[model samples]
Target: MNTTEIFLIAILVIFSAPYLVWRLGRTDYWAPLVVVQILCGILLGPGVLGAFAPAVYDHVFAPPVIAALNGIAWWAVMLFVWVAGIELDLHQAWANRRETGITAGLALGIPLTFGALAAAFLLRWPGWSGPNARDWQAVLGIGMACAVTALPILILLMEKLAILREPLGQRILRYASADDIAIWGVLALILLDWDRIGRQLGFLIAFGVAAVLVRMMMRRLGKADRWYVGIIWLALCGFGADWSGLHYMVGAFLSGAILDAEWFELEAMDAFRSVILLVAMPVFFLSTGLKTSWEGGGPAVFAAAALLLLASVGGKLAGVHLAGRILKWPRRETHVIGWLLQTKALIMIIFANILLDKGIITSATFTALLLMAVASTMLTTPIVAPMLRRLGGA
Candidate 1:
């Protein structure tokens, strides 16, 4: 078959297999459609599918086909990340800085510390850190992965729980929003290239100046024009960042971060997000899965994943519990918040993806982080639902 035909087949498989499992299996209670989609990607990847059926894998994921799909995945994730950046309720976070700071600080910091220690242990073994990575970069990359709270995924979960607009839910959004900024900042730091330091600094200055002009134009533009201009801005920023060795995703996030969510209609923004997820993000997920490797052995990867999970979950709960004490929050509130805050899902996967792209972590480490994220996200609803009910009861 031609590359287009093969790519179409791949796309069909990407959307179909996940939907069937998510719908027919009725796994939504334990695993949301998003989580299932991610797992399906892993199963469809070279590690599982290629191992079992190399011939079929090669046919479907031919070199040309893979290239085409990768292009789609890159843009899809860029738009997705940009939307997440735009949706960040920074105004709300700043308004309630004290509580947001305490909760967000502990929520991110403790997991990062635990994850770093876990990474330190993993460093004793080979095949975890990527070839281009420094020891410090590997440790910091893994640690930040554990600390990530996928703001987009967290928002989806809150919507699922019917509390997205509730006071508690909004509170959670504030905390996650603050952490989102930090996560990207850490990514920029991790991706910093000393050889390209001048370019990076130039990118920052150019970005600041361009951002001001864009903001000025946005304020004067019609709502419809804003969307078009915003996309153009996304592309330009992505270009600038990539040229500077900071990665285009960094630019994507920054482009959206500067925009006010209110610039567009709420319903339109929701529809846009939904459309992007339905149409494009499956490609990104599949691309991620295709990169998964068991070169270090499956058992080792799973073990590392388990360790990261323990660190991520344990640290998040500990930090939140500490914050609860200081803030005088109820015990039930702490429990619910902790589990919910620990939700990893897409953001951590995205974080790990960046690490892999920068050669800071190997595929084995990426697989481990991916598994840890899925497991962490799966635990959130199951654990938080009951605790939330108890809070409601009280």
Candidate 2:
């Protein structure tokens, strides 16, 4: 078949396989369609499907076909991250400064510490750290991955639980918003290239000037015009960051972060996000899976994933429990919040992707982190639903 035909078949498989499993298997309560899609990607990757059927894999994912798919994936993830950035509710976080600070601080800090320790241990073993990574870079990158919360996925899960507009949901958003900013800031720090320091500084200076103009123009324009301009801004920022040795994803996040969410119509934002997920993000997931490897072997990868999952979940809960004690939260609130905050899907995946792109972590480490994120997200709804029910009963 031609490249176009092969690419179409790949796309068909990407969307259809996940939807079938998600719908027919009835995993919605525990594993959402997004989670299932990620799993399907892993299964279809070179490590799994390609290992068994190399001939088929080569034909289906030919170089030209893969390149075509990657173009779609890059744009898809950029837009997704940009939307997540735009949706951050920093104003709400500021309004509840004390509580948001305490919660977001402990929640991010504790996991990061534990994850760093875990990464320290992983460093003892070969094949976990990438060729280009310094010891500190590997540790910090992995640690930050554990600390990431998928703000976009968290919003989706909250809507599923019917608490998206509730007081508690709004509170959660504030905490996550604060952490989101920190996550991207730390990412920029990790990605900083000494050799390209001048370029990096230039990018920052340019961004600052451009942001002022962008914000002003956004305020004056119609919503429709703003949407068009936002994409142009997203592309420009992404290019600038990539040119500066920081990843384009960082640029994409900054592109949206400077804009006010209130500038766009809420309904339109929701529809845009949903449409992107439905149409574009599956390609990103497929691209992610294609990068997976088992160089350290399946058992080692799974073990690493389990260990990281323990660190991520344990650290999050421990930090939140400490916050509950300090802030004197209501009964069961801490448990519910901990599980909800522990949710890691899109954001963590994106974080790990950047780490891999920068050669800070190996493919084995990336595979493990991917599995940990999938498992972490799958556990959220099941655990939180029961906790919420018990809290309601009390």
Candidate 3:
């Protein structure tokens, strides 16, 4: 088949295999469709399909096809991250500063410490950190991976559980909102290239000036024009960030973060996010899986994943429990909140992608983090559902 035909075939398979498993197998309780899709991406990736069925994998995912898929994946993720930024409601967290500070700090700090320790241990061996990475960079990158919560995915799961607009759900979003800001801030720190500091500083300064103008433009335009201009802004910011050595994803997030969510209609914003997820993000998942490598050995990778999982899960629960005690929150709610905050996958994968791209972590380490993210996300619904039920509702 021609590349075009084969690319279409690849898209068909990406959308099909996962939906069948999630829908037909009725795995919603344990694994949602998004989780199922991520798993299938890995299974369909070179590490699995390419190893077992080289002919099929090669025919379907040739270099050209892979390149095409990557183009889509990059744009898809940029848009998704932009939406997540627009969704941030830091005002709520600020209004409840004491509670939000203690909770977000502990929730993030403990897992970071645990994951950094795990990264330090992994460094005792080789093939984990990326080629260009300094020791501290590798450790902090992996540590933050453990600490991340996919606020976008968290919103999806909460909507699934029918609590998205509820007070409890909003509380969860507030906590995640604070953490989201911190996640990007840490990413900026890790991506700092001393050699290119001048460029990055220039990008920030230009962005600040451009942002004021963009915000003014957005306010004057009608909704339709705003949407179109936003896309234009997203692309330019993405280009500028990449040119500045900070990465396009950082620019994408900043582009959206600078614009208030209120500028767009709520339903329209939600629908836009939904459309991106439904139409584009599957390719990102597959592209991510394509980068999975087992050069350091499968067993070792799985073990590392398990170690990270333990640290991420245990540290989050412990930290949340401590916060609950300090703030005198209802005892039972701590478990529910901790499990929800532990939801990882999307944002964590995005974080690890930057690490791998920068050579701060090797493909082997990326594979480990990928596996850890999948398992962490899978655990969220099953664990939280029952807790929410017992707490009287979702």
Candidate 4:
């Protein structure tokens, strides 16, 4: 089959699947839309359908499509992070720093410690013949996964449930916003080589200094024009970071955070979010879904996935609950916080891909971690919604 045939077939399947789902009275299903496209790609790739129809999957979902998808994915990620930064109510966060601190401490510290210990113990056990740093990898992976809170999803859930104004909701919002800053910063430091630590810190300090300067400039430019200045600042930040060997997304995030502190207007963010939601983000999610794999492994692979998922979810609940207890939070609030912090997405996949790309982890481990990522996201979404609702109602 030629490229045209492959593309034509892929396009047919993509369009057809949604119509089929919609016809089945499932027009509201985002998961099936993403999942089906991914499964189709797998089937068409060298994996399954490609085994028989080589020209179709390979020539079709080829480098061009893959690259295009990746570009879309990054754009979506930027917009998502942009929304995350904008949604952060800095004034409220400042007022609630103590709660934010306690929540973040419980949410991050316990899971990281437990995960690291588990990794160390498991690496020395039988049948795991990977690297000598198997323990460290496992520990770091768990810590990173656990420390992640789905800021985008959490905010959407909070809004959907009309709990955004509640005290519990407010704290979760504030802490999650603040927590991501700390967690990602820590993950970047831990995951990157030690030699780069000075460079990374220097970049951060420089970014901070630049942000202060930008804020002053924006203030002088008048409040109404700050959003435009903010956008330019964000772009510069991302470009600078990308050029400096750090992730552009982190730069975008910090840029957004700085702007959020300065502008702090939900309406301004709403203006930006319209384009991000309708256009940019779906591409990112679709590409992320496409990169995911769930094939060729047997029971052990699936078992490892299950184990990681359990650890990810269970550890978060326990850790966040502990945070609540330590902070003298009510039981209801504690459970809600536990549920809120359990979802993982982009960073997990990105990190796993990095490790796989760097030859740090085996393909099997990468597959299992991908499975872990999907499972973690699925489990947290529904669970967090109800938990938030319960806390709000209480």
The lDDT leader among the candidates is 2
- Expressed as tens digits, the lDDT of each residue in 1-394 for candidate 1 is 7778888999999999999999999999889988999999999999999999999999999999899999999999999999999999999999999999999999999999999999999999999989999999999999999999988888888898888899999999999999999999999999999999999999999999999999999999999999999999999999999999999999999999999999989889889988988999989999999999999998999999999999999999999999999999989888888988999988788889989998999999999999999999999898888877888999
Tens digit per residue, CA lDDT, model 4, 193-300: 455666666777889899889877876776667767776777787776655556677677778777644454666665666566545544544444454443434476
Off-target runs (Cα >4 Å) in candidate 1 are: none
Residue 321 miss distance in model 2 (angstroms)? 0.6
| Predicted candidate 3 versus true structure: per-residue lDDT over 1-394, tens digit per residue | 7999999999999999999998999998888888888899899988999999999999999999999999999999999999999999988999999999999999999999999999999999989988999999999999999999899999999999888899989999999999999999999999999999999999999999999999989999999999899999999999999999999999999999898899899999999998998899999999999999988999999999999999998888888999999998887788889999999999999999988998899999999999999999999998888888889853
Give the Cα error of residue 129 in candidate 3, in Å.
0.8
What is the TM-score (0 to 1) of candidate 2?
Answer: 0.99
Candidate 3 or 2, higher TM-score: 2
TM-score against truth, every candidate: 0.99, 0.99, 0.98, 0.78
Off by over 4 Å in 2: none
- Model 2, residue 351: C-alpha shift (Å): 0.6
What overall lDDT, based on C-alpha atoms, would model 2 receive against the true structure? 0.94
Error of model 2, residue 204, in angstroms: 0.5
RMSD of 4: 4.3
Superposed by TM-score, candidate 3 places the C-alpha of residue 151 at a distance from the truth, in angstroms, of: 0.2
Model 2 CA lDDT for position 258: 97
Q: How far does residue 264 in candidate 4 sit from its true spot (Å)?
A: 5.9
